[model samples]
Target: MDITIHRPGELTEPLRRAWHRAMDESPEYANPFLAPEFAIGIGRHRAGARVAILREEGEPVGFFPYERDALGVGRAIGLGLSDCQALVHRPGVTWDAQELLRACRLSIFEFDHLVEEQRPFAEHVTGLFASPVIDVKPGDGGYPEWLRGSYPGLAKTTLKKERRLGRDVGEVRFVFDERDPRMLRTLMRWKSAQYRRTGRMDRFARPWIVDVVDHLFHVREEHFTGVLSVLYAGDRPVAAHFGPRSSAVLAAWFTAYDPELRYYSPGLMMHLRTAEAAGRNGVTLVDLGRGDKEYKDWLKTRELRVGEGFAARPHPVAAGYRLWRRPVRGLRNTVLAHPRLRDPADRLLKTVGTLRTSHRADSDGAASGRR
Candidate 1:
């Protein structure tokens, strides 16, 4: 296949349409991140993002949205800690993946979450990873029935709690596509606080994350859309889920609940509502994006393999860096590999968070009531 490189800003309507068509044609392609809107959104916000447009017989066949960084490093645009893969295209089209690197002038391409389907360039790959998902379709009666058949204990427990909570709170309601921006802000705030408490970096700290959220908020479509579902206890939002919804797949992306209301399990309730709505909307699957959460297994019927390994063009500069980076990566992996070390490492991070909070409090007290 003959592939041409194009600057992110230079993408045309035909190119975008072809890219979407290629992705739409692929059965394995269900990610919103692989969509043109997502790539364009990232390109508009992130610097140095470029699109590699592949062609055969003067017709577009594939598209990849990548960000060129210092040291000739390239990665999927907006792929920081995200579970989706890069280099999205139709099947049966083969090209020298290295040619793409040469076209883009990239040295090393790092992909922590690259898809396995694009393994033609596996020689240049770095690592392998698994992204877990749940198939929330069983044709019986949507989530409620699926849960009863799959996880009867959990279903019974959750329904019992739901009944108790509803009795206490007056009425429990689920709102989908809530038009208010305030609900999204509340979910972000809760998620941010959860990250801090759990010693994970707040993703919203990055400007692109904020822009992506705001962009998805306005992007509503049948197959590609952002659905914000909120569980309300007597009109007060208790839990909210911000995820991508499609005709057949509703991906569980981001979720959060009020800490004080954790006892009611509002998050689970919101998820239940989402699954029901997805079935009602002709959705065949609700993908709870890659993780080992017990709830996922309880709510899902099967798992799909998603993500890929990194590939790159052979450049001496990039080769040298990869060589040196290998040992460091190995050491880090080894450390994380040990369950003993991993647990302590996590604890240490949590301790550091507590200390940071204390120091911040002291500084704030010193500056308070001062102008």
Candidate 2:
């Protein structure tokens, strides 16, 4: 096997075509996050982004996209934001993890959402977690029929809420592919607020991430398209989802709604509506990502296993990096894996968030008074 590393932008047209062909041939590799375009998008903002191409018998067989810092510490490209990660390769293709790292000049590579089928890195896996997904099937009867048939228990209540929301607010309507850029900004703002309220990191506060999302929103290709689905009452946007879709898979990425309309379960409503519309548009699966969320359990048809761990070579940098990072990840995983620990942690975060938000509000008011 031969391996060559290059910046994502340096990938030639033929190399990209080969990458697409690899994805087309394997369902496991079909995620838009694994697409060449997504790699390129990240590379535009992150100077460390690189791709390793593996060849056998003079033919390209695998692509691994990652980011490497000056210290030779590496991670999967778009690690925090990407729901799926893998060294996308054609069937029967295999390579050594150590060799791959050497070619990329990295002491260690870290991944959280590694695909289960990545056997070469199997021994390096620290834990496996369930990633929920909805298998969508297009129905001629539309969203109502699709919901009724797929989730009988949820159908009546959700539909009733939808009706109430429509009557109380305005006529409820859904747009599967909303083109306006303002709605995307609205989603980011709502998501940022949701993050603060829940005591999570505000991803939108980072300019690079915002730029990447905006850049992706404009990308329209056969293997990848940024889909923005919105649910509106009259002309008011109630809920919205911004994610990437490939030919067959739609990643359920950033989703947020008008918090004032939370009583109507607008977030849940957004997911259901997105699924229905995505199915009609030829998407067969909506990846809900790896997490233990109540809504994910309620909506998923089945689950896919994803791994988290470090793949490393024999180096002091690798050992030191692992020593520094593993405990943090281990602690987080422990909190998330157990409800007893998770519940208390959640409450504590919310309390902190509430106080933080109130302080911010007061500060704003004082500033306004001064003005």
Candidate 3:
């Protein structure tokens, strides 16, 4: 087996095509977040981003795109960020984890939502995270039926709320895409404000994310495009969502609503419209992303596990550092999980905020205006 690393621009067509093919072939490859396009999308904005391709018998067997942080510390290509990570490979191929690490020239590598099958690298895999999903496939009765079937109680409650909202507000209308850029911009603004108001780091503040969202806005292809949905009360936009959708999956990425109209629960309304549109469009799943939010259980048909975090060399020196760092990562995850730690996290962003802001300005459409 031979491994090679290629910088972003150095990536060749053959490699890109091969990656797309491998991703398409892998049964576990669900999130478009793991797609080659995502790597390339983020690659365009990150420096030192590269692809690690492993070959056996002159054929590409595995590919790992990652970024090397300070002191050669490595992370999933877009670490502290991008949502998915794994070695792209064909079935039945045995990959030596240590060799791959050596090929990447890393002293330490870590991931949080690392896939279970990729566990051969580590001695132990702990921690379970839940990402909510909504099945939008028309199933036996269609999306409406699927909704009733999956969450009869929640669906009934939602219907009751919808009626009360209608009586208090007005008629509700659902728009898919809207084809209006301003609506997406409004959603971003609302999301950004929510992030700040809730003391969270605003993702829209990152230029690469903003750029990617804008790019995804117009890059609509079956099973690989961004989706924008908005709910309206008369002429006013109440709730909206900006996410990615595929032939069978609609991944709910980001969403927001008008606080003044919170009585209508526009976020939930937008999610309902998402289900309706996805079903109408032949979509089968609505991934609510990673969270333990209440609606997840309410609207979810089933649950799937996808995450990061990995096992490294565990050399005495390496093991020692990891042992020390384990608690730190745990603390960080704990903080990120709660709203209370958000302020300090936001303050930390202030230190790197300029870099984030400047990077977005240079990338233009690649990132949102503020971080």
Backbone atom clashes (below 3 Å) for every candidate = 5, 0, 22
Q: After superposition, how far is residue 179 of candidate 1 from its true place, in Å?
A: 2.5
In terms of lDDT, the poorest run of 10 residues in model 2 is: 348-357
What digit string (tens of lDDT, one per residue) describes model 1 on residues 221-302? 5447878888888878889998776556677888999988799888778777777666666777776765555577666667
**By the lDDT metric, which is better: model 1 or model 2?**
2
TM-score per prediction, in order, is 0.89, 0.99, 0.80
* Candidate 3, 1-371: lDDT as tens digits: 88998875676777766776676677556556666666766677878677888888898867788877555566777665545567877777777777777887776677665655675554534455666677665557644566577567767767777777777787777787777899999999998867766556888889887887787777665436777888877777888987766556667878899978777566776787688777777776777766666666667877777654555664554576577778887886687678778567766766565566566568885555554
Q: Is candidate 1 or candidate 2 better by TM-score?
A: 2
Highest TM-score among the candidates is held by which one? 2
lDDT of 2 by residue, 256-344 (tens): 99999999999999999999999999999999999999999999999999999999999999999999999999999999999999999
RMSD of 2: 0.8
Best first by lDDT, ranked: 2, 1, 3
**lDDT to native, each model:** 0.73, 0.96, 0.71
The residue pairs found clashing in candidate 1 are 114-307, 114-308, 115-307, 115-308, 132-290
Q: Give the Å error, residue 223, model 2.
A: 0.3
Name the lDDT of candidate 1. 0.73
